[model samples]
Each structure stands twice: as structure tokens, then as C-alpha cells.
Target: GTPDAEEPTVTAWGLEGSSLRPGQPSPALEDWEEASEWTSWFNVDHPGGDGDFESLAAIRFYYGPARVCPRPLALEARTTDWALPSDVGERVHLNPTRVFWCLNREQPRGRSCSNYHVRFRCPLEATWGSWGPWGPCSGSCGPGRRLRRRRCPSPAGDACPGRPSEAQKCVRPRCPGCGPNTCGCPDHILLGSVVTPSGHPLPGARVSLRDWPGTVATSDAHGTFRMPGVCASSRANVSAQMDGFSAGMAQAQANSSMSAVATVVLNKLEKPYLVKHPESRVREAGQNVTFCCKASGTPMPKKYSWFHNGTLLDRRTHRYGAHLELHGLRPDQAGTYHCKAWNDAGAVRSGTARLTVLAPGQPACDPRPQEHLIKLPDDCGQPGRGPTYLDVGLCPDTLCPSPAGSSPRCGDAGSRCCSVSRLESRKVHCSGYTLPVKIVAECGCQKCLPLRGLIRGRVVAADSSEPLRFARILLGREPIGFTSYQGDFTLEVAPSTQRLVMTFVDPSGQFVDTVRVLPFDPRGAGVYHEVKAMRKKAPIILDARQSNTISLGEMGEEAPLAAGIIPPGAFRSADGQPYTGAVEAQV
Candidate 1:
């Protein structure tokens, strides 16, 4: 068949093929000759298209040929419809159906070049088309190409993501907000910030401390504050607020930090409340005593007033937990005491406590009596032969009663008589008795003779010039005489031719020796016979004719007088005759 001399008409059409099944072919022009060679081209209208067949079918019509030629070549041209497998496409399908043309070409003639162009269209609605034109194609011969477009869905799920699984809704821990609150800081810390009621933060809230006797601290900008070295177990009230926000309060724990946060809400400032401590027991006198009154309130106590028996006490006393101490208490200071705790908001009084005191007992006293005696001896020369015994007594003056009756007495006579003549309440006195005298028979002898004259003198204290008293005066072979309290004494002896010694003992027991008396001649007679010289060592002896006013100064340095001797001219025999040569001595 000759090639179609007349200009050939080419018409293109699109066919819809079921993806599930195949359909029969139809013949539209019997008299026309089918083209032996045709080329297939792909059109991609959209870059990103839905995977539905509407986009795949829209380009089918542009793949068909319109008219046939008079000469048929050995090449075959046919259209086949087949469903593309769902899994065979990429994320998106560019072309659902594929078309191809096999053709024969003659060798090159003297110099002729043939060129043909094919067009393609989508079969579905305009909105349904390939993503865009297929990629670059080869020249001349039919080009077969596979096109695919990726499908990317809008990011799935909600825009904002749900919270993480590990997240939790937790409320912050808080402190018990209140002043003088018993809940205090733990062992080694102070009160930090107090959080809001809803766990919000409040900064710069003042937190006054009420450590009983004193107020210690306030909150700072971070709602954190501290009182250094304050006693633990102290109570506190915490409140916080800003200018525009309502105030709130919470009883917060003290000593809370980052690891131990305290949530404290501050309430609006209000009138303070007061709590009173119980009454204390009475204390003993002379003991250190402490009385405590524990109280609590808002705004913290301003001052602690102490009282004893309704009188105010100095508030400077050392205190603990509202306690007032009385150092070294005395019995006179015992009484009822009370205390009042006050702040700007309010005040409270504690119960009364009574204190009793006792006095110490008195000391004991014991009594006893004492006594002594002074007595004169009966014989001056022989103290051992004097009164053997003397009476003594002691009477009570202040402590005890006096003994009844006179004090017992004793003497040389061996008599049990009450020698004390006068018996006063605190004094006693007694007199010594002498032996009785006895008469003797007369002897056959001449009548007795009288002794010669005697001499005497007085002795006195050399230093005091006072007369010596109770002094012993002795003459040889004669009885000893005692000087009177005035120091006067006397001795008698017969005139004889014997040496005489006169001795005088002063009250101080000193011996004074007089000059020796020489024998006197009875026949010799003189008005004043100075027979013996008064010695400086003895009492002064004056002549019998001289007055007895003999002074110690009159005695000169002469030998002591001997006993039983007489002064001259001071004696005569008992008979009228003066013819005595010797005479027996007499005392």
C-alpha cells in the first residue's frame, strides 16, 4: 500500500481501564489503515498528586493516534489496558497505564529526514493529573519512561504534643505559718522562706520571731531570714504579701531550705492572739528558783512583764520560755509571782505560782561554874604547921543554880565544921581554929622571972612603898609572929648574954636580917642604950626609949641581930634588985 498521499488526520483518545479487571477492544474506523509505527510519551502534570486513578487516567487521551495510512508497514501498533498493581507504584503514581509503539524505518535515501511529535493528556478530571511532565526524554524514536512522585502526608497528630509520660503534678511542701508556733527549726538550721498557700513564692515578707523574752528576726527579700544560734524547738508565725495581692499566712516549719522547702501563705495582718502558760509549783527558800510562763501570739510578744506579790519586777532577769529566775532566793522573798506577755496586737497573763520559805533553827549553849580561894596561915614561921585545910566554893552567876547550904570546910583540928562563917550566894568564908590549952602541975622552984625588953619593926614593899602584909617575923627559939596588913610586927626575949638574930619576911616572901644584939648588963643603966644596930639587910629597930617610928633608912650597915638578946638599959629583973647577971629566956 502506498503511503497515505493525502494529509493524514491523527486523533487521540483516552480509555478508562478497571484496576480490578480487563475489557475488550473496539474498532472505530474500518476503511482506515492503522499506523504501523507510533511512539509513546508520558505527561506528568503535577509534582505531588494523590495516588487515586483520577490523576492516573487524566493523561490517557493524549496517548492515542487519530487516523490510519493507505500502506501498512510490517511494524505493529496496538493499545492494551492492564491494571497496575497497587504495590508496584512509588509513594505516588505518575502514569497508571503504559503505552508503546514498535515501528520499522527505511534506510536513509539521497538526503531526506523525517520528524514526528506526539502529545498526551490525562483522562480524569483537570484536578486529577500527574505531578508534572515526565523527566527528560531521548530524541527521535519512541521514548518509554517510568515516573514516580513521593507522597508526604501532613505531619500527623495534634500540633502541640501531650505532656511527657514522666511528668507529674506535685504540690510543694510548706511550713506551719505562725508566730510563736511550737514547730521549730530542726537540729541545726534556721527559718527560710514561707511559700504561698497555693505554693506560689512570696519574697520580702517580714517574719518576726517570738523567742519568749525577746523578738529576734524578720524575713528578707527572698522570703528567707535567720536568727543565729537561736534555741531549737521555738515556735514561729509566718505571713507574707505584696502590695497588690491579698495577704496570706501559713504555719511554716523553720530551718527549711532547697531540699526542705516550706510552703507558707501569708494572711492579712490581724489582731494578735494570746496563749497563757500553766501555773508553776512553789520552790524552797535559799534555792535558785525559775518561773516560766510560755505564751504565743501573732506580731510576737513585745515585752514580758514579771511580778511578785502584785509588784512589778525588773524585766532584765534571765529568762527561758517566759521563765523568770530568782537567784539565791531568800525566805523573806517568798511570795506569789505571775507574768504578762504582750505584743502590739494583744497581751496575756500566766497563772500564779507560790513560793514558800523556811528559817534555820537556833544554836545551843552550855553552862559551868568556877571558883578559887586565898587564906592566911596560923603560924607564920612554919607554913606546913599552919591551918591544914581551907574551905572553897563556886556559885552560879548566870548559867546554873547555886548549891544549897554553906560550903564544907576542914582544918587541922579534924573538925567537919562549916569554916565559912558568911555564906553569900556566890561567895564563902571560914575561920581556922587553934588547939585547946591545958593546965600543968607546978614544979618545986623559985618564982618565974621576967624577960628583958624586946624590939620590933615594920616591913614594906621596896618598889610600891606599900606596907607588907602577912609577913613572917621570927626570933631564935621564940614563936614566929606575922606582920599586920600594915606591916607591923613584934618579938619578945629575955635579957641574956646570947647572940640574937631577928629576921623579917616581907609579903613578897623576901627575908630582911637585922643586926646582932649583944648581951646586956643588968647593972649597966643608960637612958637610951643603943645595944643593937639596925642593919640595912633587916627591918629598922629603934631603941625602946625612942618612939616606934623607926624608918628603914635609920638602919645602917651593921651585922644582923641574934635571937634571945636584949638591948641595953631596956630591961630589969622582976625583983627590985638590979643584980641580974643571967636570966632564962622567955617568949
Candidate 2:
């Protein structure tokens, strides 16, 4: 089969938006033949003072003698703008084994070879050249990747069967106490941070050098710590410890040129603690009953074992977890049931709950409400001994029948909750007058949404009393509502919310973005919080001198030429507030 007329992968080199550079090459002026091996880009002369004279001997003289091919397979010649030798419209010479030169005298008056560079492609050995030496480790310390390369001998042939480039894991020798080339040296300061598993900064963590005693530091509220004279561009083993977390260690990356920063991640730990436990349930013999148990711990409990009358139940047959659903309950299955939660730290056994299964056609719930007592506030207490107590009454969570096609589905289908069906408003006579209280008078099953309480607040400027009106209210990142014109806002808190996280964004940019984590009451009770928003932009200092005029790099710097002038205060912090902290001017 004939070889594919593969075009040489010509890479454009030099300045952007420019037609010519000192010795830059054009992308399109290279040879179209497939390349077996290519010498590094060689340029022996510049397009200044005289015409560029890039001879083969000159390239070998400046570079190593083995850098150039004695006899070449193909040659490429180009101007910086991709103009080929034919299109250059100037007298020049490009010999594959000799030299690529251009004389100003030979070019048309006031013209030259557009600044040139050359490349040579040569035939190869069997399939590929021997693999080159492995490159330096990508990372200064610890594990990283290293690369080595080999060249296909014949680009015209089927790609030498395998990859031309290869990579492997690079392992640097671990340093005990800042040893040889393994560590970068001369760095002055070492900076590190301790964070929770969720990446939140964990303040108050004590950080100390692994082997250096008395060298201790503490993370601030931002979870960051600094150590001076730590690493001379050397690797430093650092560890962090806190009260309720596993000790975490990290290799601090430090070197001569910059301040070294490392992050130590701490895993919060706690013994298995039960948050929700199984409760006693009464159900008809043929009905289903479900008991749920939840445990909270670091590395959340994933293993739960249920027991029946002190006997461990077969997990393979039951296949239940935190929630155990028993279908077609039998009298024998009715007994004290409990669950044991296990985590890496420890295991906890939940309190036992009784499962009473009655015969068919039996009522599972009592119609009468239990007498529940409540404590009145200290100011509303009796003048005598203990605080006055009132019988507010209570409704148990028992199974009850549902009404005909009405209210929300209570518990599960065909089942309901024994909830407060009626409430009686009474007065508790106190020192001054009386405090009105609602007492549970009846218990029945209906629907259950249980109206949630409201979260009300007013967003206003922190420094000034100006209201932050019409700000978007985001609940768990979803748009829930907007503040009114008076900056007052209210929304019903979700029933399952333990932490109410909200973000208020000001579309008008008058206020910095505000994020708040509010305390929540699991019971249906309204919570009030005042939100103070910091004003956004601030007046910044500037250098108004004429010497501070920006020169916009007619000199060819990639950055804007505003070196002498104070930069505009257009920069913002990560939270979208006007940045007022320390900033590096060089950046």
C-alpha cells in the first residue's frame, strides 16, 4: 500500500497579531511530507543589522554537532507570516543539507527575507529511536507523573505500532529532615490550612512541625496558619490536631522563590450517636408497621442491625436498614425491637421499642388525648415555689383510620396519625393577669401537612439604615422569594430543615452578597432573624500624577502598561464585595 501523503504538523511560533518576528517560523510554509524525526527549531541569525543567515554548519556550531542532520530527508523554509520561499518575492537560498540564507543585497530594494527559521526531517532506525531520558518529576515532593519520549523512525509507515510518548509514575525519595535534591530550598515562610472533611475551615486546630518541638501554631478563624523560617525550599512534615477530629498530616511544599502553602484536611470524628430511634407502634395483625432509626456520626453510620426480642434478626431475609418495615405483622413478630448502629469510631444500641400486633378488626389508637404538661415562662410563673405548670394535653403517634377522601394522606395509605383533632383555648392565671394557651381537646386521624412556621427578617445596610429592597431570596440555592420594598421578607421553613441556609443577592449591586446559616426550630414555631447587608463598592485611593499615565506596551508586554499608577478599585472579593484587603500590585 502506498504511504499516506501526511502533512507535517507545522506549529506556528512567535508573537500574536504580528507579521514578522526575529526568527519566528510560519505555520503553513513547512514541508508536507510525513516527518520521521525532527530537529529542534534552529535559527542562527536575526532579521536585524543584516539579512538572516542560518547555515547548517552554523546551527551545529551553536547547538551540539549532533543537533543537525548531515543529510536530510526533507527541508522546510518559511517567513513568520507563512509566506513560502516562492511567495517571499525575495532572492534567498534553502538547501536541505547546506544552509538557508537571505542577503539584503539580493532582495528587492527595501526588502528582506521576513525573518526565518528552519526545520529538518530525517529517516530513522528500525521502528523508533531509543526512549529519551525521563523528565524531572512534575511534583516537588510526594507522588507525581513523569514523561519520556521516543520517535517513530518512519512517519510514512504505519505509526511504528505503538505510542511515541509514554508516561509513568515518578517517585521522589522522601526526605527525613530536609535532605538533598529531593527538596527545593531557601523558602522563608511556610503557610498551611486545616479544614474539615467538607472543606470548611476548621479554626482553633493546633498545628505543629512533625519533628520540631515547640514550633506550634494555631489556625485562625479562616483556618490558616503561618510559620516563619520553616523550609529552605525543603519538605516539611506538618500535622494538625483538634479536640474531636483525627490528627491529619501533610507535606508542606516549600521552596526558595515563594511562600509555601499546604493544606491539611482533618476528618471530624464522633462516636455513633442516635438522633432518631424506633418508637413503639400498635398495628392490626394484617397491617404493616414501619420503625425508623437514625444515627449521626463522622463517616455517617452505614451499618444497622435490627433485633427481635433480644435475638439478632437475619439481615439477608429482612433486608432492612435504618427503616424496618414489617408487612403482614403476626402476633409472634410483635415484641421488643431495637437497632444497633455501627460506624468507624464506635457502635451504639438504640432503646428497645414494643411492637404490639392486635387481631383483625381491632382499633390500634385510643380516641382520648394524653394529658401533656407544659411549663409557663418565668415571668408568668406563680408567686410561690416552682413555676406554674399547665396540662396542655397530648396526642400519641398511633395508627388511626382516615376520613373519606379528605385532608392530606397521614402516615401511609390506609393509615393515619392520632393527632390533635381539636384545640381549646384557655387562660393560665398569672401574677399580673392571664396567659392564653391552646390545649389539645381531641385526638383523631385526618390529613397531615402540619402548617410550617415562617422565617421572617428585614435586610438592611450594616453601616447605614438604608433598606436592601427587592433582593432575591435563595433557599438551598433555589429561588424562593424576594424581599419587599421595605426590605421585609418571610417564607415558610421546610419541615425537615435543621439548618436554614439562605443567600440574598442584590441585583442593583448596592449591597454585597449575603449568606447566612440560621438556627431553626424543628417544631412549628416562627423564627425571626435580622439580616444586615454590607454596602458593596467603596472609594479607592488613586495616583493622579501625569507620570502615572499608562503606556499600553508599544514595548510588547503581555500585561497592560499601568505600572506607575494605582490600579482602579474594580477588583472584588470572592464573596462579591469590594476587596479591602492586602493585594499584590505586581499581579
Residue by residue across 539-562, what tens digits does model 1's lDDT show? 334344322332223224664344
Query: Candidate 1 — worst ten consecutive residues by lDDT sum?
Result: 409-418
Q: What is the lDDT of residue 190 in candidate 1?
A: 50
CA shift at 421, candidate 2, in angstroms? 6.7
Go through the candidates in order and give the clash count of each: 67, 5
Per-residue accuracy of model 2 over 419-438 as CA lDDT, tens digit each: 87899999877667888889
Cα-based lDDT at residue 37, candidate 2: 67
Give the C-alpha miss distance for residue 335 in model 2, angstroms: 8.5
lDDT of each: 0.37, 0.68
List residue ranges in candidate 2 displaced over 4 A: 1-282, 290-315, 320-324, 330-362, 368-415, 419-449, 508-513, 520-523, 536-587
State how far residue 427 of model 1 sits from its true place (Å): 64
